[model samples]
Target: MLAFGCTWLYDGAMSRSDRFEIFLAAPPGLEEVLTDEAREMGFGPVTAVPGGAGLTGQWTDVWRANLELRGAGRVLARIGSFRALHLAQLDKRARKFDWAAYLRPDVPLRIEATCRKSKIYHAGAATERIARAITETLGAPIAEDATLRLMARIEDDLVTFSLDTSGEPLHRRGYKEAVGKAPMRETLGALFLRQCGYDGAEPVLDPMCGSGTFVIEAAEIAVGLPPGRARRFAFEDLAGFDAEAWQAMQTPRPPRDTPLRFYGSDRDAGAVRMAGANAARAGVAALTKFTCQSVSALTRPEGAPGLVMVNPPYGARIGNRKLLFGLYAALGEVLRREMRGWRVGLVTSDGGLARATGLPFLPPGPPVAHGGLKVTLWRTGPL
Candidate 1:
C-alpha cells in the first residue's frame, strides 16, 4: 500500500484510545537517516534502535508516519510486551492481554511469530497460542492472507507484540505503476536525496531516470505531499481508527510555488513515457519534465545548478560489468563539463563502476543491501 498528501477515500474505519509505540523500520544501515527524518517531521522523543527507529505517539502519529514518512519501509505499532519464559506462561499472558484494545472482533487476523535465544523457541506454537487467545477473548477470525498482522518476537525470554499498521511498504507511494529494470525503491531514494542535501527548494535532474523515481520523489517532497496519502492503510481496520480525523490529517498542504521543474531522462523511449505517466499520477507532472534522451546528449537545464542524481543499472541485474565503465565515464564527463555548481548522488553496486564516473566523489557511504546486492551512494560536492 502507498499514499500521498492528495485527497483519497477513508475506506477502512475504526476508533481507539491507546498510546501506541510506533516503530519505523528502515533499511539495515540507514537507521540514523530515518531517525533524523522522524525528528524533522516533529515526532517527539524518537529513539534510533538497532534495526529501526522507535517513538511514542498516538494513533494519529501512526497514521501520519505511514502517510508522511518517506524513509520508513513499514510502520509497526507495538501494542505491549512482557516476560514469558515458556509456552504455558506465554499462553497464560496472551489470554489476559487485552486484544480488544486494538483489534476489531469482525475483521480477520494473521499472526507471525519469531524466537531468538529464548526458552519458547517454537514460533508456530506461539502463533497458535496467540491466535487461540484472540479468538477466545476478542472473536477475530484467523486468516493466512489477512492484512492485519499481529507480529510477536520472543528474545531473551521477553515477548514483544506489534501490529503491522502499514500493510505494505511506504516506498510504493501509490503511484509509479510502471517500473524499469532494477528501479530504486522510493524509501531509499528519499534518503539518498537527504544524503545529497536535497531540501526540495532546488531542481533535481536524473539522467538515468529509469521510471523517474528520483525526479518524482523530489517533486513530491518539494510539494509537501505525504507518501501514504493516495492509498488506504491497515490501521483503518483496527479499533479506534477515526476515519474523519485521519482524512483531516491527510489533507494536502499548500505546495511550495517553485518554478524550478524537476527533470528526468532515459535512453529508452518506453521508460520516458512511463515516467511521464507516473508523474501525472503523482500529481507533479506540472512540475516535472521527462524526456527520451541518453546521458551523452544530456545538457544542463535552463536554471540554477541543482542536484544531479542517478541509480544506474548494476552488473548483477543487467548488462556485463565491463561495458558499463564507458557508460559511467560518459555520464561523468557530461556533468563535469556542463553542470557547474551541481551536486551529484550516484548509487552503484560496484566500486569500480563508481570510480569509472571520476566525478571527484568523496568516499562512498556504508554498503546498503538492495535487491540482494550490496550498494553504496557516491556523492560529490559542487562540480
Candidate 2:
C-alpha cells in the first residue's frame, strides 16, 4: 500500500513541449482499417490493438486527428501510466499526474475507471478515489454530467489514464438529426466504403439507404469534406488550444455538384424522405438522389461503374428477421441481374442470409462488433 500525501499538487500550467500517445478506439474488426487511416494522416508507429490502434505524436497531431481520421470513434490521449498494486497506490500515482496541464477549474470533467486482474478489484471505488484526488488537490470540480470524460484502466497492476478528445463518438457527425431503425454509424459506413475500394472518384450506390448514411458519407468523401466539420470537439476546451488556429482550419469550401456521383433507393417512402432531409442538412442534396423505390427498381446512373454498398436488415428483432431474409435475397437478385461489373459490399449479422444471396461469395474481411452484435462485412467484385 502507498501512503496518500499532499506532495502531489498541480498548479494548472502548460508545458511548452510535450508528446502524447493516442489510443484510438474502433469497432471490433476495423483496427487495421483505422491504423491505415492514421498513417495516411501522418501518425507514426501505428500498431493495431484488440479494439483499436496506438500512435505517438505531438499536440499538433492531436489537432489533426480531430480534423481528419474518419474511421475512429474517439481519440484518447494517454496522460499518465504507472504500476499500482491497490487503491492507495492508484490514488497516489493519479494525483502525481499533471492534470493541471489539460484540465481547468472552470472546465467540468468526469472519470470512468475499469479494473481487471489487479488488487483494485472494485472499479467504482478506484474511479471515486482518483476523482476525489483531482478535485481535492487540483481544485478541479467533479462533474457528474460532464461531456469531457477521462478513462482509467488498471490491468495487471498497471494503471493507464486517457482524456477523450472527441466529445461524443465521432459517428454522430451532427448532420443526422434523425435515424432509421437499425441504422449504421457514419464511421463504420466510411470504413465499409474503404473496404470496397471506394476512392471518392467513382459513383456509389446504396440500395437500402437508411437515413442516407452510406450515401451522404460517400458524397462527403467525394467532395473532400472533413468528417468533424459540423461539430465541436473536447480539445477545443483544453488549456493550450489555439482558437485562432482552429478557426483558420474551418475554411469553407464550395460544394461539389457532380451528377450521379451518389445514388440511393429505399422501398420505404419515409426512409427516402429522411435520407433527403439528412442530405440537405449535409449540403450534398444536389449531389445525391434518394428515391422511394425497391431494390428491383434500382438502376445504374449514366456513367462509369461504381460501388454498391448495402446494410440490409438481419432478423435481430421479433417478426423482422424472417421477412428480411427474403428482402436480402431480392437485393442479391437485383445486384446480380442489374449491377454486374459494379462492386458490392454488404453488411449483415446472419450467415444464412448471406449464403442465400446465391452470388459468388468472396470471404468476408473480418467481423465488426456493431450494436452489440458481431456483423460481417462481405465484399464482391470490381466486376
Candidate 3:
C-alpha cells in the first residue's frame, strides 16, 4: 500500500481485460506504422497520438507490445490524463489522481514535464512546480537522478501523464557489445525487415551488413524469437510486474531448425565478429551465417529466392561518397549477376547512391528519420 496526498491505494491484482492503457512512441512519421503493429499484436482500439499511439489492453498486451511491435521506440503506461489551466489546478488534480496506485513511496522517481500551447508556457518552471507538488503532496522524496521516470506532456491545455515502462530505449536489446561507427537501431532493423516483406521462409542476405543488424533481426523474426527476450525492460520494476508471465512468454519453444536461411557478409572483419556475437546473444547464431566478405564476393544461399536487403554506408557518416559510388556500382553488378528474382530493399540517405544500385526501384517514399539523418527505404522486385 502507498499514500499520495489524501488518496491511498493498494496494488490490485490485474485481470485479463483490466483496460491498461499503453502509449507507444516512435520516430517521426512512424505513428501509423507503430499503431498497425500494436493492432497486429492484439492491442485494440489503437488511436494515434502526436509522437505515439494509445491502446487499451491488459498486462499480456503490454508484454506483446514490448516483444513484437517493430516500429515502436518505447511503450508507456498511461497513468492519468486531465486538462490543467494553471499550476494550482495541475497540482490539485495530480494529488487526487491516485499516484500511490502506481508508484511506491520508497522507490525514487523523477518527473519530466513538457508544456505546449497551454497556459503553462514555461516548461522548466512548470516541471519544477509539478515536481514540488508531487513531493509535497505525496511525501515522496524527489531524486534528481531516478531510474523510475514519470513523463508529463501538456498539449493544448490537456495534460497526459505516463510511466515509462521501457527505461532504456527498447532498441538496446543487450546484444551488440560493440557497434560499428554508424549502426542501425534494432527496432528500425525489425521494422525495415517487416516493410521488406521478410517472412523468414527463404534466404535473407545483407551484403553490407554493418554490425549485422538486418541479418540478426531477420534471424530473430524467422525463428519466431521475441525481440525483447535479450533485454531488461523498465516495466520489470513497476508495482505489479509479473515476472513469471514474462518468462513464460519467452519464445515458447526453441527456434524451428531451418537450413541456413539467414546470411550476412561485410567487408569489415571486425563488423563480422561483432555481428556473430550479437547473433549468438540473440540465440539465432544457428539460423545466421556471417562471412568477412565484400559485396563483390556475395553469393546466393541454397534456398527459395528471398530478400536481399542492404544498408550500405552512406556519405553522411563513414565512407566517402566518391568511394561509395564505386562500391554501389559493384553491388549493382553483383546483384544483377547473382540475385535475380530476389526481392531487394535498400536503406540509404542519398538518392544517387540508391540509384547507383540500378535495381529499378519504386519511387522513393517520404524520408524516415534515422540517426539524425533523413533516410528512405527503397524497394524493388515484384512491387
Best by TM-score: 1
lDDT of 3 by residue, 1-383 (tens): 00011121223423435676677887666667677777777777887776777777666777778777767788777666677888888777776666666666667788888887899777787778777767776666678687778888887787777787777788888788878878999888777777777766777889988788998888777777777767777677666567897887864677776665688998889999998998888788878888998788887677678888888888986768899998888888888888878888899999999998777897766688898899888998742
Error of 2 at 217 (Å): 0.7
Give the Cα-based TM-score of candidate 3 against the true structure: 0.90
Question: Clashes in each model (backbone N, CA, C under 3 Å)?
Answer: 12, 2, 0
What is candidate 1's lDDT per residue for 1-383, written digit by digit as tens?
A: 11111121112222355455678888777888889999999997888876668887788888889998989989987777778899999998888887887899999999999998999999999999999999998999999999888898887787877789988777888888999898899999998898888989899999999899999999988888887879878999988678899889977788778778999999999999999999999999999999898899999899798999999886887899889899989988999998999999999999899889889999888888898898899999999
Please give the lDDT score for candidate 1. Answer: 0.86
Superposition TM-score, candidate 2 onto the true structure: 0.92
lDDT of 2 by residue, 1-383 (tens): 01011122233333636555777888878988988888876787888887788876666777678777788888887666677888888788777777777887678888888888898889999989999888877787788789888888777777777788888889998899988888899999998888788868888899989899999999998887888888889988877778898787777776655555689989889999999999999888888999999888877777788898988888873247778778778888888888878989888888888878876779888888888888898888765
- Position 164, candidate 2: lDDT: 86
Using all chains and alpha carbons, the TM-scores for the candidates as numbered come to 0.94, 0.92, 0.90
Error of 1 at 200 (Å): 0.5
Better of 2 and 3 by TM-score: 2
In model 1, how large is the Cα lDDT of residue 11? 21
- Predictions ranked by TM-score, top down? 1, 2, 3
